[model samples]
Each structure stands twice: as structure tokens, then as C-alpha cells.
Target: MSLQHFMDTYALKLLQAIFVHLGYVVLCVAIGSAIALVLAVLLTRIPRFSKLIMPFLSILQTIPGIVFIGILYLYTGMRPITVMIALSVYAIFPVLKNAYSGILHVDEKYKEAAKGCGMSSWQTLFYVELPLATPSIFTGIRMTVIYLVSWTVLAAMIGQGGLGEFIYRGVGTNDNRLILMGAVPAAVMAIGLGALLDKLQKKLTPRGIRLQEQSESGQSSGKGGI
Candidate 1:
């Protein structure tokens, strides 16, 4: 279809679907990150439980996306909320794993330094550990957004409309343009969001870590040059 015809036919509906898709992704990621971050923090506080829990979460991550969505829809019926719940659970794993790994790997000496400075356990966590973990945390968040953007299309399977609706219709009607209309925008959204998050991760990452890494690399090269 020509630009004019495509616009005349689908401009408004496409815009609406895009907005719906964005909303779904945003909401799911927010909820998932919050839940995962808390769980990660808890696991860090109680190391024994982490051994037991992390595997469960890893298993959850392995469940097929379509299977989870189908199961949720079966119970909740064809509602956007069902999609939201399913997607949010799927988004939780990366953030949780990163958060757990980042916090757990904080140097014991730095943690002791925090304690020596009169910081309590939680204070040490918030001020020192989390700051050090910012890069990892943000990386997880970026992954969540990208995953959600691609997966939101699945929402249309149960009648919760998004770009998936167009893609589904296009497939059924054998219209390639409609499929592209849905797929191309989704790809753009994923790429755009991923780029934005990359920038965000850089900004949130501690400047000291970057500088230290750069200095370490320089010293390594200087030694090797001899």
C-alpha cells in the first residue's frame, strides 16, 4: 500500500496499538524490576536461601514465553492484565540475577570499610553496595525493557490488542504490509529503547569504576610495553 492509503486505513489504529504496546512494556518492566530487586536484596541478606531460591528463578526463566502467556490467559481470560502479569514474571529473572550477583560480589574489604565508617548494614548496602552494583542493575533493566517490547506482541493472542493484532491479522489475511507495519515498529521500539538504556547504564555507572578500569588497563599496557 502507498503511504497515503496506509495512513488513511491504519494511521490512527496503528498509533493506538503503539501506545498500548508502550504502556504494557513500561508497566510490566516497572513491576518486575521492583519485585526482582527486592527479592535479590533479600537473598543477599540471607545467603543460605539464595542457594535454594536462585535455581527456582532460573527454572522460571526457562519456561517458554508462549506457554506462560497461554496459561495466564486460561485463568484470567483474554485481558491485558493477564498479559501484564505474565510478562512481568518473565522480566523478573534478569534483574534478580544481576542484583544478586552484583551485591554478593561486593568486596568484603569494602563492606568492612563501610562498617568501620559507622554505617549500619542497610546503610552499607544502600550507599556502597548498590552504588557499585549500579551498572549491573541497569544492564538487567535494559534487558527487561527489550524483552518486554518484543514480547508484548504476544498479548494480542488472547485479544488484548497491540502491534500483535496487526501482525496476526496480516498473517491471517496474507497481507505482508500489515505484518511489516506491526513488526517494523516493534523492532524500532526495541532498538530505540535499548540504545536509551545503554546511555542510562553509562550514566548510572559509577565514574570511579570507569576511571579505575581505565587506569588499570593503562598500567597493564605500560608493564607489557617493557
Candidate 2:
């Protein structure tokens, strides 16, 4: 088919698919981040269980996305909720691991200062630990967003609309153009979203940390020059 002809036929469908794909990405990331953050905080309070729970979550992450979605579909009957649940579960691991690690790694001095200021446990967590952990948490969020861009395509497997519809259809008919139509957009979406998250990470990071990093980088460059 001619390029113009293809566009005329599929442009509206493509737009719809992009919106559907974006909706899934946003909802899954939001739900997954909330769940992960809460769990990470709770685990911080009870460190002993983390050894067991973290490994279990890592195992869940090992499950292939297609297989997980397929299993959920079997049990949940091909519903949109099935896809959402699978995607959300998949989204949990990276954020959970990073957030847990980030909070744990916060310098003892900082925590001591917070305590010296008469901050409560909740206050220390909110006003100090989480802010310092923002960069790491945002890294997990970016990973989740990029993965969801591609993973949301699985929604098409059950007839919920997304760019994956074009990809799967193209594969069935051996049409490379159709596959590209789906794939190129998803790649672009991932890149664009990842960049946006990078910018957000910078904004959310503490100014002191950013300045320290910049200073360290400059000193390293000067040493190399010498």
C-alpha cells in the first residue's frame, strides 16, 4: 500500500492506539510506584522481613511479561483489568528495590541531623530520607515507564486496543510496514518519556546533591587535565 493510502486508512486507529497505550502506562506506573513506595517504607521499619520479601519480589520480576499476562488472562478472562494487574505487578519490582536501597543508603549523619532537629520518624522520612532518595526512586520510575511502553502492547493480545494491535496483525500477515507502524511509535514513546523523567529527576533531586555532583565532576576533569 502507498504511504499516503496507509496513513489515510490507519491514522485514526494509530492515534487511538497511542492514547490507549499511554493510559495504561500512566495508570500502571502510578499504581505500582505507590505500592512499591509504601512497601519499601514498611520494610525499612522492619528490616528483617526484607531479606525474605525482596527475594520473592525479585523472583516475580523474573517471570516473562508475555507469560505473566497470559496466565492472568487465563484466570481473569481476557479483561482489561487482567492486563493492568499484570503490568502493575511487573512495574513493582524495580521501584521497590531501588526505593528500598535508596532509603537504606541515606547517610547516617543526615538521619542523625534530622533526629537532632527533633523530627519524628515520619518527619525524618518525609523531610529527609525520601527527598534524598528521589533520584533513585525516579530511576526506577523511568525504567518502569520505558518497559510499560513496550509491555502495554500486550493489551492488544486480548483485544484491548494499543499499538500492539498493529504489530500482532502485521506479524500474522507478514507485513513489515504494519510492524514498523507499531514499533516505531513505541520506541519514540519510550525515548520521549525517559527524557522527561530525567528532567524530572533533576528537578526533584536536592540542590545540594546536584551541586556536589557538579563540583565532583569538575574536579575530576581538572585532575585529568593535570
Candidate 3:
């Protein structure tokens, strides 16, 4: 069913829901990425912590998103903050794994080079390691944002008012158009946001890497011509 009829009736409400849904996603991603990045950096500095923390986080991630959100709703009474907390926890794992893997997998030679240049531990991390690891880190962020957008629908389950409101209402009423109203915009948002982030990933990637990739592509073309 086309969303036009439903949209015509509730255009303002739907627009508000979209913005609210987006706000939840933004909050969750911002908080999740900050915490994940910090934990990733800490784990890298003390490798043994990864042994314990990684397993714990993996276990937490294993719990279904709805289950965790439901549990939080029971305790917190349908508050938006509870929904945000649940979303943040769900959003954290991708970036955490990416940051840990990205930093840890950085070439040892680069570390040695940084040290040889008299860079301090902190300086080496920020200047040399993070720049090289940026592409991977951005990959994590891209995934997290997309995940959060999908997950934000759950906010409606708690009466916090998001696109999920229409979705759940539509489900209860057996209205296909209402369901599409919620689902279609969400899918579009996720795809559009993912594309934007992909562009950002390229831009944020180190210039050296970008140039090398371009040079390699040129070389490959030259070889093909030969």
C-alpha cells in the first residue's frame, strides 16, 4: 500500500517521529562510540584486559536487543533514557571491535619508526597509529550508525515516540500502509546515512593511504594496458 494516504493524514506526526527517531540514533551512537573508543584504546594499552573485557562484551551483545530493552523498560518505566541506554549498548560493539583490531593490527614497523623519531608513547598513538587505523575505525562507525538507525524503531515499543509508533500501531491494526510508512522511511534513512558515512570514511582516511590507493589503481591500469 502506498504511504500517501497515511502520510496525508498524519504528516506532522510522522515528521516529528522521524526527527525523534533520528535524535535517539544520534544520542546512542555518540555515547556508544565515545565509550567504545576509550575502552578500545585502554585494551590496546593493556592487552590482557582484552582477554576479560572482550569476552564480557561479546556475551552482552549475545542478548537480543528487544530482550535487553524490555528488561530496561521494566525497571525504568518506559523512559526515553532507558531506550537510549539500551541502544547505546547495542551500538557499542562494532566500534569497539574495530578500534581494538585497527590499533592492534597497525604495523609494528610504524611503531618502531615513531619511537626512532623520538615520539612519546602518546604522540605515537595519536599521530602515527590512529591516522593509519582511521579507515577501519570509520568502518566501525559506519556500521554502528546503520545499526542504531534500525534499532531506533524499538523506541516506540517503550512509548517514547519514534517511527516504531506507527509500525507497532499498524501491526496491531493490521494496516499495511501504516507499517510501510514506518519501515520505508527507516530503510531510506539507513541507506542514505550509510552512503554519507562511506564518503566520510574515504575523506577521513589518511591522505597517504588515499594517494597510495590511487597510485596502485593507476599502476594496475598501466599493467592491463601492457
Candidate 4:
């Protein structure tokens, strides 16, 4: 078939798949991030809890993507919602763990300053710590989103319907071009989104509190000279 014929036949379905994939990924990321942030905050307050959560998250990470998808499909009887839930579960760990680590690792001096200012625990967390942990949280979000999008193709196996439909159809028909058409676009989207998110993080990251410390030191030296 001509390229035009292929476009005429499959372009709309391809667009639909793109939207479906994007929707699933965004939903998973938003839900996972919220849970991760809350967990991270709780873990920071109780380091022992981090130990408990981290091991479980690590085990979740070990489960293969295909296995997770299949298990959900078997239990949920081949629904798209099952695929979404499975992907969300699989995407949770990195964000949760990283957010916990990031908030906990904020410099002691900043925490001290917040306390000295009589900031309550909640106020210190919202005002002093979260902003400092933005880069790490962004990292976790980026990773989770990328993984969610890439693994969504497996959703097709359960009749959940996405770009993977094309892959499966092409395989059934032994059509190399159709297979490439679906696979290539999905890969491009995953990498493209990952890069865009990384760029966003870099632009948004603060110039570290270390910059403030350096400026203070320089000002003190000039005052001494004066």
C-alpha cells in the first residue's frame, strides 16, 4: 500500500492511541506524585518508616512490566482501567523514594533557620523544604512518566487498546511497515517527552542555597576590608 493509503487507513486510530497513551501517563503521574510526596513527608518525619517503605518499593520495582500488566488483566478481566491502575502502581516507587530522600537531605542549616524563625513543622515543610527538593521531585516525575508511557503498549495485549493495537495487528498480518509505524512513533514520544520534562526541570531549579552562602561570604570579606 502507498503511504497515503496507510495514512488514510490508520492515521486516525494512531492519533487516538497517542491521546489514550498520554491520558494514562498523565493520570498515573499525577496520582503517583501526590502519594509519593505525602509518603516522603511522612518518611522524613520518621526515618524508620523510610526503611520500611523503601524495601517494599524496591520489590515493586523488580516486578517486570509485562508481568504486572498481565496480573492486572487477569484480575480485572481485560479492562483499560486495569491497565491504567497497573501502570500507576508500577510507576510509584521511584518518585516516592526520591521525594523522601530529597526532602530528608535538605541542609541542616536551613532547617535550623526555619526553626529559629518559629516556623511550625507544616510551615517549614511547605516554605523551606519543598522548594529545595524541587529538582529531585522533578526527576522522579520525569522517570515515572517516561516509564508509564513506554509500558502502556503492553496494555494492548489485554484488549485495552492503544498504539500497541497496531503492533499486534501488524504482527498478525506479518506487515513490517505497520509494525514500524507504531513502534517508531511510540519510541519518539517517550524520548521526546522525557527530554522536554528534563529541560523544564533545569529551567525551574533554584541556583542552590550554596549561591546565597557564597554571596554572604563575599560581602563579609568586603566589609572586613572596609
Best prediction by TM-score = 2
Which stretches in model 2 have alpha-carbon errors above 4 Å?
A: 221-226
Report lDDT (CA) for all predictions.
0.91, 0.92, 0.90, 0.84
Task: Write down the worst ten-residue block by lDDT for model 2.
Answer: 204-213
TM-scores for all candidates? 0.93, 0.94, 0.92, 0.86
Model 3, 55-100: lDDT tens digits are 9999999998889999998888878889989999988899999989
By summed lDDT, which 10 consecutive residues of candidate 3 come out lowest? 1-10
218: Cα error in model 2, Å? 2.9
Overall local distance difference test of candidate 4: 0.84
- Listed per model in order, the count of residue pairs whose N, CA or C atoms clash below 3 Å is 0, 0, 0, 0
lDDT of 2: 0.92
Off by over 4 Å in 4: 202-226
**Residue 64 Cα positional deviation in candidate 3, in Å, after optimal superposition:** 0.5
All candidates: CA RMSD (Å): 1.8, 1.5, 2.4, 5.0
* The best candidate in terms of lDDT: 2
Clashing residue pairs, candidate 2?
A: none
Better candidate number, 1 or 2, judged by lDDT = 2
